[model samples]
Target: MQIISQVFQEISPADFFYRNKEIAGFSNPARAIFSAIRELIENSLDATEPFGILPDIYIRLSSTGETEEEGFYTLRVEDNGSGIPSEYIPLAFCQFLFSSKYKLKQTRGTFGLGGTMTILYGQITTNKPVEVLSSTGDSKIYGYRLMIDIERNQPIILEKKVYENDGQWHGTIVEVNLEGDYSKAKPKVIEYLKQTAIANPYANIMFVDPKGRLYKFERTVSVLPPQPKETLPHPHGVDVETIYRIIRVTKCKTLLDFMQEHFHRVGRQIAKSFLEFAGFPEDTDPKRLKPEEIVKLVQAMKSFNGFLPPDASCLSPLGEEILKAGIMKELEPEFAAVTQRKPSAYSGHPFIVEVGVAYGGKVPVRSDNDITLYRFANKIPLVYDESGDVSWKVIKSIDWRRYNVEPGMPIAIIVHICSTKIPWKTVGKEMIADRPEISREILNGVREVARKLKVYLSRKEKVKREKERLSVFLRYLPKIAEFSAKLAREEKVPDIKNLLRRVRRFGEG
Candidate 1:
C-alpha cells in the first residue's frame, strides 16, 4: 500500500467567496437577486447620507427571456450620490476587503464585501462583465466594463471610456447580468424596499421589476440622520492579537504613549497606571516588548477598573422625532410611539438602540401572534432570520399584554441598532447575535415605546367607553323629557335636542 500526501493551497478572496456564495447571502437564485439589490442600495444610502443629500435611487430589473422565472436577468441601480472617483471605480466594484469604512464609525456595510460579492455572484452565474459609470462632480464621466480575476483577486477591465459632462450630476450607475428567480424574490424585494422607506423617510426610491411594474416610495421628510464620527477603540474590546498589531503599526514610541494614543478613555495617568499594573517600564519601547509582556499588557487593560466605557461619538442613531415621523407616515398607524436610547457600549464598540411601536390602521396583525417586527442595523433593513436575531428574542420575551396588545391586534414593532461594530452571528448579515448588552438595550428601548403605546391604547379605550355611555344617556334622556312634559300637561314638549347637543359637546370635550 502506498501513502497519500495532502496538498494545501491559498486562494484569493474572490475565489474563496465565489466558492462559498452562501456565506455572503447569495444562497439561491431568489436570495441572490435580493442580496444584490440590497448591497447596491446600501452603498447608495451610505454615499448620500454623508453629503446630507436626499437619496434618489433608481433600480431596474429586466429579464432576457420571455419569462422572468427562467434564464438570465439584467439589474441596473443608479443613485444621485457622491460618486466614486474615476481611479477607484474598478477596485470599488471588484476588490474585496478594500474599504474606506475601516474607520471606527457606524456604517451599513462593515466588511466592504457586500457590493463586491454581489458582482462576483453575477459574474460566476452569467459569465458577464459588470458595467459601471461614475462622475465625481468632475468635467467628465468615466465608464468601465469590468470582471474580477478570481484567482488573482484583481479587476480585469475589458473596456474603458470617458464622456464629457456638464459637471452637474454626481452619482454612480452599475449594471450587471445574473441568473435569478425574480418572481420568487419579488415579495421580499418589495418588502425590503418598503421597510427601507419606513426607516429612511428622507430617501426617494423607485424600482421597475422584471414584469415592468413600477414601484416608488417618495420621501416624506427632508432631514437626514446625523453622520457618525470616527472614534478610537476602547480597551476592553482589544485582545492580545489586536494589541500586537497596534504595537507594530502605532506611531507612538513608548508603551505608555501607545496606550494613551490608540485606546479611547485612556489618558496619560491611565496609561501610567496600566504600565505599572503590567509590570512594564513607562518608557519601554512598545515595539521591543516581549510577547509575554504584550499578554500582560492586554490582561492589565482588561482588568483596569477606571477606564471609562467606549466613546459613543461614533454611533448615529435615528432620533425619536425622525423615527416617529417615519413610522407614522409609512404605517399610518392610529397610535405610534418611538424612543431612542442613550448611547451604550459592548466590549469596546459604542452602540445606540431606537425602537418604535405602531398600532392599528395599515399595520398588519399576524394571525399567529398579532405582532410584526421590523429589524434594522445601521439603517439597513434585516429582511430575514427574524427568529434568530437578538431583537426578536427581546421582543418575544416582552409581555405584550402589559402594553394592552392582544391577539389579532394590528401592531408593528420596529427596532434599529446602530454601532461601530454590530454583533452579527453569521457572515450573511441577516441576523444579529444575541449579545447580552445588545439584548438589554433592545429590551429597554422597546419597553419604553410600548409604555407609550399602552397609554395611547388605554386613553383610546377610555374614550370609547365614554362615547358608549353618552349614546345610552342620550337615548334615555329623550324618553325622560317626554315623560316629564306629559306629566306636567305641557302643550309644547320639552326640546331635548338642545340638551342632547350640550351632552354631546361635554362628551367630546
Candidate 2:
C-alpha cells in the first residue's frame, strides 16, 4: 500500500476568518450587510455611552452597483463620541484579534474581529479600501483610505490626510463599499437598530437606507447607564491555562502575593488559606510552578467555595426606569412594566437581568401568535438566532395566558443581561448559553414584569365589562324614564342626569 503525503500550512487570523466568513455572520449578502452595520454602530455606542455622554449616531447605506437592490453598496456610519486617536486608527480598524473588550467588563464586540471583519469583507468583495475619518475632539481630523494585507494581517494605508476639525465635533466616520443584498437585509437591519434604540434609549440613532428612506430613533433619556468597571477574573471560573498565563506574567515573588494580586475577592488572609488548601506554601514561588502544579492549583481553586460572590460593580445594568422609558419611547405601549433582578453570579461571573413588558398601543401583534422579544446583552442587541438564546428559552417556558396576555396580543417583551463575561454559545455572539443561574434570573425578572402586566390586563378587562354594561343602560334609561313620566302624567322626564353621571364615571373607571 502506498501512502500519500499531505501538506500542512498555518493560516493567519485574517485568512481564517475570510475563508470561514459565516463564523462572523457574513454568510450571505443580506447577513453581511446587517452584521457590518451592527458592528460599527455598536462600537460607536460603546465609545460614548460608557463615558456618560449622550450618543448621536448616524448610518447611511446606499446602493452603488447598477442593480439597485443587489450587489455593491456604500455603507457609512458616523458617531458623536470620543473618536479613535490618530495613532491607534490603523491597527484598531485593520488588525484582527486586537481588542480592549478582553477585560473583565461589560462591553460589546468581545472578539475584537467585528470591525475589522467588515473591512476585510468589503476589501475582498468589492476590492475597495475603507475610508475612515476620526477626530479626538481636537483641531484636526485624521482621514485615511486603508485596507488590510490579508496574508500578513496588517493595515495597508493607501492615503492619509489631515483636515481642519470644528474642535467640538469629535467622533469617527467609517465608510466602506461592500457587496450586499439591501432589499433582503432591510427588515433585519431596521429591527436591529430599533432594538438598539430600545436597549439604549439615551442614544440617538438615525439611519438612511439604500432607498433614501430615513428612520430616526431620538434619545428618550439624558442620563447614561453607570459604566461597567473592569474586574479581575474569579478563581472558580478560570482554567489552568489562565492560571499559568497569570503566573508567567505576575511580578509577585510568592504564591500568596500572586493570588491576592491576580484574582478578585482573594484577600491576603484568603490567599494564605487558599495556598495552604492547594498544598502550596504561602512563600512558594508561583513562577517556579510546573505545568502539573498549575493544573492542580486550578482544580483546588475550582473546588474551593470560600470566595465571596463576585462584585456586581463590574456590571452595568439598565435600571428599571431607563428600560421602561426606552420601551415607552419605541413601542409607545399603553402600559409598560419593568424590573431589574438583584445581582447574581454564575460560574463566578456576576450577572444582572432587566425585564420590561409592554402591552397595547403601538406594540405590533404578530400573526403567528408569538411574543415579540427584544433581547440585549450588555446593551448590544441580539438580533439573530433568537430561538437559541437563554432569554428565548425562558420565554418559551412561560405560559402567557397565565398573565392574562393572550396569544397574538399587542405585546412586546424586552430582556437585558448585564455581565462581564457573557456565556455565548457561538463565536457569532448572537445566542447565549442557557446557564441555570442566568435562566433563573431571567425567569424571575420576566415573571415579575408579567405579573404587573396581568394586573393591568385584569383592570382593563373590568373596565371593558363596565363600559359594556353602561352602554345598555345608556340606550334604555332615557326611554324608560320618558315612558314612566308619560304614565305618571308628568310633562318632563324624571331627572336622571345625576344617575347617568355616576354611571358614566364608573364606566370610565
Candidate 3:
C-alpha cells in the first residue's frame, strides 16, 4: 500500500455544513426532517409577526418515492407573510450567512444559517431541486426552481417564471424533497408544532403529516406581542473585534462620535469621559485605532461604571395575559399562573424571562415524572436537550413542594427567554447556558408564579373540604327536619330547602 500525505484547503460554508451536518441538528434522517420543518416555520414567524401581519402558515409532508427510494418525502411550507423580493430570492434561500438577522435584535434565526442548512441538507439527501414561489402583495408573482452548488456555496437556478397576480394574495411557498423517516420523527415534529402553537396562539398553523393526517392549531388570541426593535450594541458587550467590524463601515470620524453612535445609551459626555478613563485621546480617529489600543478600549469599557444598563426595547416578551390565555386554550389547566419578569441584562445584552405554571385538567400526567416542561428562546421552542437546560437546572434546585407542587401531578411549566443574544449551550440552540444572572432571573420568575399557584391550590383545597361537609349535611339534615316536624305535629318541613340553598351558596363562595 502507498501512503498519501495530507493536504490543507479552505472550504465554503455550504461544504462545511454538508460535511458536519450534525452541528446544525441534522444528525440523521429523522432529525433532519424535523429540523427542516422547524427552520421554515421559524423563518415564517419572523417574517409575519415582526411586520404586524397575522400569520397563516401551512405545512404538508407527503411521500414522494416510497417504493423506488426508501423513505423519500416531500416537504412544503407556505406562509402568508411579507414575501421576499424577486431579486433577493436566490440569496435569501441559497446563500450562507447572508441575512438581516446579524444585528442587535430578538429573532428566531442564526444569521440565515438555519434555512440554508435545511436547503443544503435536502439537496444532498435527495439530489433534488427546490421550488419557491412568492408575492409581496404586489401585482407580480415570481417563481424559481433552484439547487445549491455545495462546493462553491452558490445557487444553481434551473428555472424561473413570472405569473399574473391578483394583488389580493401575499405570501411565500417553499417545496423541497429529501429522505426522512417520518414515522420515527412524527412524535417530535408534532410536539414541536404543538409547542409552537402554545407560544404563538395568535398565529394559525395547519399541518398535514406524511400519512395524510391533519393537525390544526388555531388562533386563540387576537393580539400579537409587540415587535422587537433593532438596537445599538452596548459598550459592555463589545470586544476589540466587534469594534473593528463597526469601525470598518462606520461613518463617524472620531472615537468620541463613534462611541456615541454605535453603542446603546452612550452620550457625548459619557463617550468623552470613557475615553479619558481609558487614557485614549477623545479625537483619535476611530478607523485608525491600533490593535493594541482597541484592546485597551474594550477592557476599559467593561470596567467603566458610567454606562447605563441596556433596556428591554430590543426584546419582545409575551405578556402574562397572552400566556395565560394560550395555556388555558391549549392545556385547559384548572390553575395557571404566569409572570413576565422585569428586564435584565448580561454582557450588555438585555433580556426578559417569562415563567408560567399550570396544573390539573387536561395537562398530561406522567406516572414516572408527571411534569411537562417547555423551554423556549426568542419564541422558538427548544424541543431537545432539556436535562441540561438552564431553566431546568433552576427548576430542579427550587423547593417546589413549598408551593403545594410535587412529582406525579398533572403539571406543566413554560420558561421563555427572549433576548437579542441567548446564551445557548450549543450551536444547535437546544439548551440555554447556566449564566448566574440569567439563572437568578429564572429562579425569581418561577418562584413568583409558584407563589400564585400556592394561593390557588390553597383555595381549591378549602373548596374541596367545604364540598365534603356540605354533602354530609345534605344527607342528615333532611332526617333532622322530618323528626322535628313530626314532633311539632304541624307536618310541613318548614322550608328546609331554603336553608340548603344558603349553605350551597356559602360553600361555593
Please give the distance, in angstroms, between residue 269's alpha carbon in candidate 1 and its true position after superposition. Answer: 2.4
All models, RMSD in angstroms: 2.0, 1.9, 2.8
Work out the TM-score per prediction. 0.95, 0.95, 0.93
Model 3 reaches what TM-score against the true structure?
Answer: 0.93
Task: Give the alpha carbon lDDT tens digit for every residue of 1-509 in model 3.
Answer: 88798899999988888898898889999999899999999989988998899889999999887462378988999999998999888888898877878878899995578888888988998899889999888998899998998889888889999988886678899998888888888889998998898889899999998778999999988899998888999889988888888989999989889989989999999998899999989889988888898899999999999998999898899888888887887888888899999898998989999999999888888667846788989888999888899988988888878988878888888899999999987667799999899999999998898899889888988999999989998998999999898999966877789899999999999
Ranking by lDDT: 2, 3, 1
Give the best candidate by lDDT.
2
lDDT, candidates in the order shown? 0.88, 0.90, 0.88
Question: What is the per-residue lDDT of model 2 for residues 1-509, given as tens digits with 9 covering 90 to 100?
Answer: 88898899998999899999998889999899999999999889878887777999999998897779557899999998788889889998999998867888888878989999999999999999999999989899999999999888899999999999875778899999899888888889989998888888999999999789999999988988888888999988899888878877899998988988999899988888888888998888989988899889999998887777788888999898898888989888999999999999888789999999999888888888898898999888898999889999999999889999888888888899989889998777899999999999999999999999999999999998998899898999999999999999999889988899999997886
Put down candidate 1 lDDT per residue, 286-371, tens digits, no spaces: 89888887788788888878788886778878898888878887899988888888888887788899999999878987879648
Please report, as a residue range, the 10-residue window in candidate 3 with the lowest summed lDDT: 64-73
Off-target runs (Cα >4 Å) in candidate 1 are: 480-495, 498-506
In model 3, residue pairs whose N, Cα or C atoms come closer than 3 Å (at least 3 residues apart or on different chains), thus clashing, are: none
